[model samples]
Target: MSMKRPNVFRGYAALICAALLAPGSPAAAFDAPARIEQNLSLNAQCGLRAFVHNLNGGLASARVIPLVSGSSAQTQAAGGASYFNGATSNIFSAVTAANLQANCGLADVTNLVQQGAAGAYAAAASISLTFEATRTSNGDRYAYRAEISGAAATTVTVSQTLVNAAPTVTLGPPSGPNSSGDYTVVATLSENSSDFTAASLTLTNATATMSGSGSSYTIVLTPVTDGAVNASVQKGAFTDSGGLGNWFASNTLSFSNTVEKTQKVIAQFMQTRANQLISSQPDLTGFLSGSDTGALNMTVTEGGGAFGFASAPDKGNGVWARLSGSWSHESDRKTSYAFGVIGSHVNLSPDLLVGGMIEFDFLGQKEGATRVDGNGWLIGPYFVARSPAHPLFFEGRFLYGQTKNDISPLGTYSDSFETQRLLTQFKVTGEIAQGRTTWMPSLQLSYTTDTQRAYTDGLGNFIPEQGFELTQAELGLDVRHEVLLPRSRGRLELTGGLSFVGSSAKGSGYASLVVPEYAGGRGKVKAGANYTLPNGAVLVMDVYNDGIGAAGYESYGAQFGFNLMF
Candidate 1:
């Protein structure tokens, strides 16, 4: 029974095969496309001729012939042309139509024609232009004039029809070709086509070399070697296995080859010590005042890389002095964000002082080969409290803060800025360091509404109503750090910062204090310095000339003070 079952399956399989093999069966009905090959050549004096053959099976001779017109042959023969070169006549390669199609293959040839090879004698062709020359021996010398012809060669045509997977030649469309955009074509030549070694795109203007994938090849035309070519035309030639020359020539002398524009990318960062670069003075000097606020620092940056960090500062305000130990981190060496805490005890009426701050900034990197460039933002919160016994030597209390920022892009004139805090306050009570102890200064400027919002409009142009308001102004300068022994724990420093109140200025409804004569003045000068101690602790000092003085005019003495960073 099993044997019988196997026989039945075999019979069914044979029936299916018979149906598929039948002449009219679907499988049998599909036929492969007919394969055809073509080769073409033209001469200046000689007309034009093309060879074609079928790849399936065809008999044809692939011989190079100097195409000639009946009229030209008769005219030349009558013009003293002799048969003296008959002895040197040599036949090269057997070429057929099939050979032509095979050479072109199924590939793109747009760049070849448009960027034709350099040199004067090299024959070049695209779908539009054709050039060739044939030399015949005349006694001891051979001479063959050039022939160049093109049908609407002034333009390039692009479309699905023009983009052939195989090389081809065609005249312009009925409407002519497009004067712009890139196009492609395929060309097939006999395996025995001429050699390109001696071929040239421009005799005196350009030169070229032969290159491609197959033994039979496609020609690429470029401008002259070590010379510039007009960026508007195509030139070059394709050499076959045989040593015959194909040439590309220009009829109007205005032809040129096209090249795509060049493009480059930019990535960088930058930072500089502006004061050091501009000032000639080696030492910073000024009176010390108020409580030490802190130090102002500048950092350099590097660009084109990512920066990551831990926690950042919240938006709030109050000032404190620098501590013995403070550490910071940076992305590409620029302080992207920072955090720390510290407290100190002074002998002044408002004695004990303590607080901490966390800061965040978004200054896009600086600009340079190694620098990052752009705008940035910074925000941090802080707290400070001091005793309240002395009026001339008293105490203060305050906290919280935030900072806003902006910058320009690489090489452009665009710029931006933002404010992160609306109110500022400082409250710290501690004994003055050294013999200057027993006295402390408190400066407080506080705001209640929209504390750390950024100024959105009129960036760079100051507008008061849109800015944060200041509540108070205090000025004080005193020496500290003398008790630390030989001033080693870094030099004692006096630091100060100002707070401007937002109010309608110039009697205008705009709430802004536009007067530079006040602490908000455009030209107020501020300065500070620091010294390092053997214990690695640092003492900092600062002074700000808030442009407002006790004389009811432009007061220029030190105003605020700080022992830490600003």
Candidate 2:
């Protein structure tokens, strides 16, 4: 491709020829083969442009030539200056092996002219370059000052940006192995987060309260539905200190919301089981205590539901000794087996009886991730007295004991503790007779205390069961009707009764769970029968409910036993 000469180039050539032929201004400027490439490239970026020139197939005697910057016509250089000279940014750097100064130090040129952008795209950059060619014949120099320019770039493009990595968080497991209806979940931040709280939880089937701060936070979950529980913190639900991350949601905390009481709740369960078995021991000596002077009785018993007992005692001076055994199960599936012996006495004159009993029990319980096994022995005294004038009977009993227990959690951690217990009970009753029926009314009060040594569990948690107390009261009545057997050889007595039992209590809980506070009452009904033979043989069968049982449930069962007296 070849470039067509512009009219400016032709006219400038003609003017140069006229100057050469003229007189006074001769040698003002000359013409030779000065090689120039026009509009080579618009290389202006962040303020630098470039130009190149040569003359007569060799390094040109080129220089950056200064012409009148703002002058229109006069005030310009003498004769040889070109029309394009006012495009200087006034800042320049020439690069070459040797730079040249021409026009008597008025201009300078090296191999290259470097120009740059003007004030924000004001105009393009131009440098007046005088390229001189040497004439082969006369060694005369011919030069021309022509403007060189570049297309100044108007804008710059960049690929760098400002952003931060997002933070992440995880919702830990429902706080520990929650066996109770209540539990908690901890949301832990991968990095510290300022806005993470219970409010950030996107809860399903539960309500919560929040605690802790920064990287670790806890939300105690109270299930609102008795179904499946689902909980999570949505992405962006919380933010970091730099207010950057929330790009990921915390892990989901999910479980069944149904009641699965364990740990301290199981303690209460097992405690109530122990209390029932200890307190509800049938008084096999009741019959002997009511006997006349010199009365002798022997008893045998079996098939006690919850706690069935067997006893046999030979009576002497109102004194008797007997042995009994019982086994019981709680609503929480905890079980207790016990055996005991009682030595009793009766004084018929004023109708008073005194006795003492010793017993030992083995217990096994499991709930959630905890299991406990233990054995204990207890000894206590009891009394029964009737005021001749008042026609009322009074009874009382107290027992104290300590247990050696082994505790295992999740089949992993293990430990042991000694637990002490004291049980006290008192009752009063009166009787009214009409025809073949007798009606008895009674009121009883009992209190129990358990001092379980504070211990560290397998996972380094403290069980502060130091001492838990429970008190209960019961008011009941029984009506018995006698039916004589044929030939007057035996008699059958049937009895029915109703009772109201109430209790109040408070204690420490297990691990992070609180020992629950208790204050409530329930109604109970019972029925029983006794068969008496002429030779002092008797049979007993009874079924009753007294509003107490494993982990807080309705407690009812039956007892079957027999006796012989002379």
Candidate 3:
């Protein structure tokens, strides 16, 4: 289905948007005071009449003052006032007239109802400002100089909440040493007023030294080459940055001579334990029917950097093989591309933890077919949060894609068109320990489109074109725990998961057979075991059986995979 249409098939279009907009979503919302929409002419004149207003009770100054002249006036007025005191800032006839006559280069100030604000407001306010501006006597756009001079009658009433704030920061290591084997520094933060929120920080001649994260700074100092080093700190004032102050920890860097190396690789193989079926399951034949999917990777460390590459091969159904390549420089890594005949995956990132990814593939057409082919691109943004010491973990992914295809034989081929697709998942995992065993519980959601399209061979040599959409609303509960191992070098884990799949499919151009089957909703259960090899390599295997099958018989399969990182 096109993005322009509603989701009658799966009805997930709205659901996805709502999910993305949910709390703790990847990106932050826009918090600008006004979404200004006007020509530069009016925007320029707006500078003189700007004022601050406190809508959330008169506890603070809510806006920045913009004036052309009288820096003295501003300092004596808004500057001296406590920013948090709520006030109704009005800059109308007085300031407007004065600014026009003094700095606007206007010959006269009349019909001026200028009013503007810069702080957060309960609701937007409008001022009917109409002032007579002076132009060059030549009647042509010449720069003689037009200045509007006068003291604008401006009155600002501000109310602010007196919030008690304290200086808080993470302590970081020090850099320089003081006399008597001591080092000293200071941190200063300005008291913020009600007008705005601060979002930035800066340090002078000081370097930040911290290993972890949070609202703290580490102050580490290297001992003097001939002696020892001591350190002390003092607090300073906080000044405004270009915009809102950032509300997060800060890290600073000094000279460093540290180089690190890292590498990661994942490989999986689907083992066919029953009659290697083909006629019934088409999409599953390529990867699922294969006995093994293998991959290997390695990296070298140098000047604070590293790189690696790997390839996983699987031969099933009419599909062939896939290979992946990646590289890393410190914390940033990128995957150039992954190419394969049936299914190809590409990841461009420093680590698997998260970044951007795109996977493309050509499926459907038989191996020796002369023409027919189905190809599409799946691209999306992803993020993952994990910690070795934390019991709770989270992962999220979002993907939007479009697909197009061509028919092989003239009469047998279908028409061609574009189809859009979306995929998103959010999961949270918690780890529980029971003696020698640890269990991981997780919650997740999977969403997809439920519509598709295709054309027939009727329209004048016009090959039949078609598309289809499918969706699975799955709710799952899973547990994974570490098992007793023989040695400290090797590890083992046991896992089990249950899921309920609700599916739907629809289309116009393609036949019903091509459409995905929702069939009857069913419960699926799976249990698996994983073992760690000697050289930091991990091996995993799992078996799953779903009671109800959409195409034919109940579906059951086992998968094995391994991962190596250094």
Against the true structure, whose lDDT is highest?
2
Best by TM-score: 2
Please provide TM-scores, in order, for all candidate models, with all chains considered together.
Answer: 0.22, 0.54, 0.33
Candidate 2 residue-wise lDDT, 59-94, digit = tens: 111123233343221212111122222222323333
In TM-score terms, candidate 1 sits at 0.22
Query: Whole-model Cα lDDT per candidate?
Result: 0.27, 0.55, 0.37
The local distance difference test score of model 3 is 0.37
Task: Report the C-alpha displacement of residue 280, candidate 1, in angstroms.
Answer: 28
Residue 343, candidate 3: alpha-carbon lDDT: 29
Worst 10 residues of 3 by lDDT: 260-269
